[model samples]
Target: MKLPRSIEEIRSDFPILSVKVHDKPLIYLDNGATTQKPVQVLQVMDELYRTANANVHRGVHYLSDIVSERYEAARETVRAFINAPKREEVIFTAGTTASINAVAFSFGERFVHEGDEIIISGMEHHANIVPWQMLCERKGSKLRIIPFSDQGVLDLEAYRSMFTERTRIVAVTHASNVLGTINPVKEIVTEAHRHDVPVLIDGAQSIQHGIVDVADIGCDFFAFSGHKIYGPNGIGVLYGKEKWLNEIPPYQGGGDMVASVTFEKTTYNELPFKFEAGTTNFTGAIGLGTALDYLTALGREAVAEREQALLAQATGGLSSVSGMRIYGTAPGKVSLVSFLPGNIHPYDAGMILDKMGIAVRTGTHCAQPVMDRYGITGTIRASMAFYNTEEEIDALVKGVRKVTEMFA
Candidate 1:
């Protein structure tokens, strides 16, 4: 597949593209951290605040009604985005961290027991790993890790062997934020189901790459962040099967989450509302809906193709640089390419890149366990998005080469 010659049109939609850093045009490659929002998403949030700002599900006035309608519409949009079976299966949270925590707190409390096991892969972000650890610690359950091979791919045989009747949950990342390895979630979920273990997929990195079908994967829970998919921050989604969601207890208590609260007892609301508590991020959710729409209009297949080609170009270009060591050389990876230059700290390299107006992330990327597994401190990560262009990749290559020349 041919790389996009010019992403000028798509880049124009993001106002931040015009930003100047160090007297040079910004070359943003820190997409894995959080993506630049499109004009459409910003406009949607602006419109919501201007015309439809009000508390949802409680007000009867015109503005309140409109706000409530838009808020619910955003939930529906998220439902379709992940191809979730029912709208009630979609629950909004602060971000992937909170979403995962909700599942850990509610489902973990009910299902987990002493001597039970929760399986996680070595490449999991702290959001996915720490919650399960806490749950296991609280419940006297054991936490098992699925080790990865030297090439950064999960060891399937080892993973299969880890499953047993005692395995209560299998939580893994759909894609590694640091390594860019796209996991075989469908296979993992199927294997876990054979033993009747629930699976939760952290999709913070995968959602922007291509379409994510919760039904197809058959996982019990899927979590992703809005900001990583070109939406506003402080908004995310947790998709669970209707049956599973119905079974899990409420994570929080608040006004909207309760159907009736009396002096003695209270009843929780239905499906999603039972979990969602307090005033939500209304404008951020609206922005998330707009972001999903923007990505849908661009088409998933096209976005995937473009990003894969860019990954190929980036890997190929960087391979030739002397003294440069790239991590996550696994096949079927995503748009991220992480590496370390000889005798150079990733933070120092990141500072040098910033001087050249190339923004990239450096460090453990919230996957400190993965770093510990590999015996490395950290890496320099350049993650891509659909709106990025070949020129940006070229700039990244040039910047790396310059860094290598100076350090190596």
Candidate 2:
């Protein structure tokens, strides 16, 4: 598959990719945690801080007005990127963790009651799992899990049978961070809607890999982190349907989320702002918008193709090693691989790889349940991005071989 631009050209956009570690050229394969930001995103953020730094909304000053416009424009960009029906449906939060927690609190308060059930898959990151678990504990509800196969595919048949009248909402990941499984969320949403259940997709891992159309998936809510998509840290988008946004209470009681405050009572602001309490991340939001624009210009389809090619290469190269055990072998996974080289502990393997200037994620990867399911403690994971190259994949293979020999 052809990339939208040359690999060198695309890699040049991210300055950090050129940096060395331990006197060796850096080969970063940790995109699953957070992607390196492009210069375009960095420049926009720097420019905003330099020229238009100010608080957003309800300000008469020139800096505030300009910054506010940019901030709201970032919301619109997020709305468009996710293909949400209304711009007001988009809410900015600290990141995916914050987004999921906000929904758990607000949506739980609005809908959940004693004995109610919430359906989440076994492969979910803690961000998706714990909030629901907290909500269940708070509301005297039960948290139901959808089991996955040994191959890392969710049991849709079991998922369909799990919903009941007491079911409040269905929360699932669009892609598994550890498994790299690209779940059939559209079908999952359809099944939930058949039961009159609303669905929330954790898009933190999927958004950076491919197109994420909320309308197409038919999920009622979606959450993703900006940093995972080559944007600034501490910014994320939560897209909720208008009906739900209107129904749920504000997540926090603070400055911008209020319409008025009286001694007797306090009224809340309108949609979007209702969820955005206190001071907003206006500069980070603008930076995220620039990052989205940069990704769009690169052509998401072509980017996906490049990443898939890298995934294939990594999978093949890693599989050839003796005593290698890959954890997630789903057929249509994203660009990541989780594995153990023989009985070698993941932490030891990771340290050796780091010394060789190859960066990879180690341990349970925030998905301890996934590790438990496989009867292992943790795995060394190499996650790829569009900027990653074939040479890097080859290097990773060689590094793993070295790790295996050292342990032997």
Candidate 3:
């Protein structure tokens, strides 16, 4: 499970790793929020802004052509990265939230109706849950939740039984952000298809952790944020099957989304462009492509192994601390742990950890339903990435213990 390059060499790619917060080295465990970008992604984006800054697909000038080529090339990169069946299936959006909204609006308008049911899981982030709820409200449809167990595992039997002729679509997360559970999305897709329903996978947390093949997973739509994977912010990908993309109407209407416009009739553009209305984030897309290339070079399998080792170290160290109660103990989960240190409020403990230069998220983490399920307000989350080290894990353990004692 050795990395293709030395860990120190890999760490050097991200300059922020060397920073000192509160006079202690920053132990960034907030990777689930957004990953720190490497210099490669930053440099490419800066280069684009400096040299070839132009609106894509709208100009015939030199700069516009170059930027457009690079922008569309980024789409190919996304298609290859996810093993999508076609390049036109990849649509760039603001982020995962926007991607889901596009699907919810377009898909719901086309297919959902009164009394139709939308199925989602208990572990879904608000991004996944809220959009479907809004759609259900608009169409008089019902939102059905597939509950998870105390161990954070979804009840597959319940999910299968819930499906009926009324079910319209099934949307779920490939992994749980709060629970750190890697769901059986392939199986979930298979089961949904059995009932003639399509599935959408929210890959915001799952994309950077391991290999993702939408073709293999057999999902109709896959959405993820670039910033979650060391790419630029305000950029994301929504990969839809070609058939589905063509079937659904455009999510937006603006310049490039229309092929030809008359006062009376306007024909929408084809596949990917139909969804990308205004000026697309060409620089962000190129930067995301660079980030994907960087991950490809690093070897996703090795990166997963490295992160798993870090997760193992973190889980074991955190578990040994007295009065520490860890959540999301599902087997084969990703490299994150959410826990409460005794009776300490998560924010209080998080503040102490921050002074020690450990950055962890202390909140419901945009998954309030999960917190309600556990009957708690929030928990402290330490999410790891491949660039993290075992030393950082140990430092976090010591920091948490200090926070616990201070609170006590």
Q: Write the per-residue lDDT of candidate 2 for residues 228-257, one digit (tens) a residue.
A: 999999999999999999999987888999
Candidate 3 TM-score versus the reference: 0.99
Off by over 4 Å in 3: none
- Clash pairs (backbone) in predicted model 1: none
Q: All candidates' TM-scores?
A: 0.98, 0.99, 0.99
Q: Rank the candidates by TM-score, best first.
A: 3, 2, 1
lDDT of 3: 0.95
lDDT by residue (tens digit), candidate 1, 1-408: 333334778888899989999999999889999999999998888888787788888889988888889889999998988999899999999999999999999999889999999999999999998898899889999999999987899998999999877989899999998888999999999999889888999999999998889999999999999999999999999998888888988888997999999989999899889988999888888899999988888787788999988898888887777887899988878899999888689998999999999999999899898788778899999998877888889889999999988776
lDDT, candidate 3, 145-169, per-residue tens: 9999999999999999999999999
Give stretches of model 1 more than 4 Å off. Answer: 1-6
Best by lDDT: 3
What lDDT does the true structure give each of the candidates?
A: 0.90, 0.94, 0.95
Angstrom error at residue 260, model 2: 1.3
Question: How many residue pairs of model 3 clash at the backbone?
Answer: 0
